[model samples]
Target: MAIRNVLQLGDPGLRVVSEPVADPGAPEIAALLTDLQDTLTHWRTTTTYGRGIAAPQIGVPLRVIFLHLEQPWPLINPTIIAHSEEQMVVWDACLSFLCIFCQVWRYQQVDVRYQDLQGAWHTVHAEGDLAELLQHEIDHLDGILALDRMTDIRTMCTREEFEKRYRERSPYAR
Candidate 1:
């Protein structure tokens, strides 16, 4: 269980649709979760931004997501159960594309069902940034990147540009 190299943008492995995690308690699943935690921690420590990561981002094509919000945890075989009609656009980034951010529209609210490492099932209702984060990570399971979700191609910009133009200068600052 070590920090694994994150698959960069354009890696073919990043496009593979992740398979459902059949056994949440499998040793491989545990190892993958550990790798995700280590990798996400390393990224956040260095960049000050990563909050969540998906298994596929680390070359493990399994439906798993590691989140470091108020608490750190893993969601195994996550699926969106419901979404609100209202949508909002926000700047989204990815571990695969560490240098850029894209404006993407996502549902304002979502209900997700997922399993724990112990194989127990649970559901979570998320909204705002947490909802957006869940949707972003779930999209990775289907081979979708934040770039692919952009409503306007022109909205994509380098992280440095994003910081200069919008980080604290605009109302869109996240």
Candidate 2:
């Protein structure tokens, strides 16, 4: 598999809701997973940071997501099982919009149900940064982006500006 080009924010494909993968064991699905990992790895190599990617981000309208949270894994037809009542705000960035960052409010925790590469169902409990990242990627499957999660347009800023003015104090600060 090769690194597929990531669709940009303005791309019509990015706005399309992904369809669920009917056959998780399909060969095409495997290739798509590889392509996703390759793309994510390539991006991380260049930027030094990347956590997750949804199928739609690569112009694939399939309910699939690749996550690299200490361990890399593919999530198929992922659904949020439950979320905490509490919410937190974070400066969110996206590969689709590398030029900007937006302040977004997200659930503090989440329980997600998803399928493994073998097509077996599984669930994961995530909190803090992991919770935020999963929510972001799942939103992509529904044709949602971080900008849409922002309460005010004024809170959005150029990546450079975010770095200069808020990076050190940002919740996502390294």
Candidate 3:
């Protein structure tokens, strides 16, 4: 269990599609989950912005993600089974690319199927902030970044610029 360094943008590893976890209850997965939690915690306390992290962010090509919301939630082999017809534009930032924020559209709601550490399957219905968060994290598993979803290159801006011009108006800010 360690605070593994998050792979930054432009790192080739960040663009590799992660493999499905063969065993959700494997010891290595447990350790990876711990590392993700630690890394996300460190990011939140230090930068005040990270809500979740995917395994690939730490150079692990596994379909795992850790989210810190009301609690620490680890999803193994998560897949977006359904998504709402509606979408919303959001100013999204990634721990992998903390220096910038990109404007991207995300589903307003989603239903995800995933496994727990115990290898049991479960489904979650998420909407609003939670829905956007899940979609972002899951995209990481598929080797996609918010930058890839940007509608226009001009919509991407420096973190400082985003804070100055878009932070308050961001849907995630609410």
Residue-pair clashes per prediction, in order, are: 0, 0, 0
Tens digit of lDDT per residue, candidate 2, span 76-166?
9999999999999888989999888988999999999999878899999999888999999999999999999996789899988988998
lDDT of 3 by residue, 1-174 (tens): 798899999999999999999999899999999999999999988988898999999999999999998799999999999999999888899999999898889999999999999999999999988999999999999999999988788898998998888888765354
Candidate 2: misplaced stretches above 4 Å?
A: 169-174
Top lDDT prediction, candidate number: 3
Using all chains and alpha carbons, the TM-scores for the candidates as numbered come to: 0.94, 0.94, 0.96
Q: State how far residue 38 of model 3 sits from its true place (Å).
A: 0.4
The whole-model lDDT of each prediction reads 0.90, 0.90, 0.92
| Residue 119's lDDT in candidate 3 | 93
Candidate whose TM-score is highest: 3
Q: Measured by TM-score, how close is model 3 to the native structure?
A: 0.96
Off by over 4 Å in 1: 169-174
Candidate 1, position 47, lDDT = 79
Question: How well is each residue in 1-174 modelled by candidate 1, as lDDT tens digits?
Answer: 698899999899988999999999999898889889999999988877788999999888999999988789899999999999999998888889979888999999999999998999999999988999999999999999988889899998998998887777432243
